[model samples]
Target: MREISLDRLRTLVVIADLGSFAEAARQLNLAPPTISLHVAELEARIGAPLLTRARSQVRPTAIGETLLLRARRLLADADLALDEVRRQVEGLTGRVRLGASTGAIAHLLPQALEHLRAVHPGIDVQVQVLTSQASLAGLREGTLDIGLVALPQVAGKGLEVTPWRRDPILAYVPADWQPPARVTPAWLAQRALILNDSSTQLSRVTNDWFAAAGLYPQARIELNYNDAIKSLVGAGYGATLLPQEGEAAELDRRIVRRPLRPGLWRQLGIACRQEQVERATGYVLQALARLRQ
Candidate 1:
């Protein structure tokens, strides 16, 4: 069977409302013959007489009334679907996939999320906790829209890697241990240590820091997540070095954070495929920029 035409359906609805073919034509800005033909074709397709001449005012047959009810709903739904697509095309609403480390997700992403919610509530950001290398791979493979990655990156072709922020690496230790004003590789080396696994960029950075001072420290346990490492430090399991994310409102009373003597700083970059940047992604990029320090 041939599919029903929406234009013809619209004509049926208008003619029923006006009760006159001439008035429907005037309202639709169509010729009178075109309005009559529209209804004629609809009735032919449905194999039923849709309209009738009752005294003076034109009215719909029982079958016509059923189609009119369904037509109104279909037209309304079609219009709504088009409007949503328009909003997405205009960047007023969309979904963006983002990748970042667990540390950034915990300390940094919430502020960006809040900003996005206030400004572009219709934009949905899907986040994935990934290593810096994995984030870059995702960008290359077209799986991720944006990545918050540890720096010293060489932006590949079509990729934009921009330095976003710098944070100092600090020593987190049991608060009960009264240590020096500043932590050095030698001092930290002597204590029981918790370190990020060798697979992480932070692990490499920390290892380099220790190696520079002619001290190669061994970790009592290896873990990747920063929050978990902090918890271990609070429990006096060991001390670990991690980036100071921001001026935290509440300090963990059980664990004390102290700056490194050599002032080791961690650099992070905002990475994205230049060609793949959409309007919604740009909005999220702006939100992340607000955290630049």
Candidate 2:
């Protein structure tokens, strides 16, 4: 099989960006004919015409368009790899891309990221805030360098999970109401509740909890945004079910928080694909470790 050459890929990128072979050649300091020959040789090796030439302009063929996308990514990765190698040798920098669940982001991630930046300023951290399901999906697809997710959900195949924290479930009650004598599913059902959006895995988990207990709350509203839910609960509209341990001052001041009886809780953890253990995943683990202590 013929190996694709960097020069060939560069020719494609140059032409695509500058919109003309002559312009690309001028910018690249190569003669126009040389650039044309490079592209033609690459196309012949690949057994496809890479460009559709018009009277005044040139465009990529379908296969060329696809190759163009991959070429850009390949070139970018090559550059990143070189930088990473140098940084690794010098112990100066690392890049980590992490997917975070909403609950984790609101509660634990800010402190973790701040500490990482303070201690390892050379390391670049990119965070993607998403639902638990989406976080898992991103990890599976290799787009996410690492992830923090609620446990049990992270125990799936192809990944490893490290327990990070256990957060309790808190009951948001009307401002005018006092703490219930005891927290129970039936007691929770007595209040008008504002629930998380139906699409969220958190919502599904909470709903399943209710179903298992043989009780259902009177849901007055169903929304996703935690801030919005807190706002509604603050206005004495209805109670909400928020994680017991995460940041909840907005909801706390307006409503009362009571830990559910029998200890209903969610476990938060770091998840990473096994293959990523030595790469960006290590950075995420190190960050979480420092934050915990």
Candidate 3:
């Protein structure tokens, strides 16, 4: 039997993902013919046609889909082996691609990253701000090493999730406006409300909180970034609800954060592929756990 090559397997995975040999070639920095040859070679070795090519697109055949699944695991294990060697020889020198929600990125990850950098100087971290759904998709697709996301997440097969923190969702109103010690959904519904964009889980949670009380406030504006939302709140455009980590001193002084009447909270946590948890990623997880403590 002929031996399979990791390079060819990686090429196959990329081609399957991109659905075009030309696009895969561009991504892998190889010629289109080279990609085609790799696929043809693999198909010959496996004794079956792996992909169905159309005029404009390509899709893996049934057998190809099975192979693609194993290919991902093989590639992941091979990378893990290399990362392990690098960690032992050079002291945790590797890259960790982290996905996080906007609120978590803005308030939570900075301190954890600072501690990681201070301790493991060689570990490089790249953060992508994404919604919980997008982050989970990235984890499944292997684009993200770990994700900090809002919880009640449905952990798919081969994914591990752990609680990180429970941040209280607070209402931000103009400093001059007199708010009750505990702001109620009804009370908030009477005022102009700024909220997170509909694309975010926070927005859904906020909407549910109001719906639970049978109140749906007309949102004055929907902004995605936390800073922008706070700026608008401080400018007195409207009151907005957001997750708060301790005191948000960064907000404009003209805005004041008031606790919600029912004390709504957003649960946050770390998620990673089960196979990816024993390397530099493990160290980062430890740091995050310590920070939470």
Number of the top-ranking candidate, with lDDT as the measure? 1
Ranking by TM-score: 1, 3, 2
In candidate 3, what are the lDDT values of residues 71-162, reduced to their tens digit? 99999999999987877456467788898867677777788888999999888889898888888899999899889877788989989888
lDDT for predicted candidate 1 compared with the true structure: 0.91
lDDT for predicted candidate 3 compared with the true structure: 0.86
Query: Pairing residues by index, what is the TM-score of model 1?
Result: 0.88
Every model: Cα RMSD to truth: 2.5, 10.6, 15.4
lDDT of 1 by residue, 141-182 (tens): 999999999988777888889999999888998988877999
Superior candidate under lDDT, 1 versus 3 = 1
lDDT (Cα, 0-100) at 274 in candidate 3: 85
Overall lDDT per candidate, in order of appearance: 0.91, 0.76, 0.86
RMSD of 3: 15.4
Tell me each candidate's TM-score.
0.88, 0.65, 0.68
Clashes of 2: 0
The per-residue C-alpha lDDT of model 3 at residue 254 equals 92
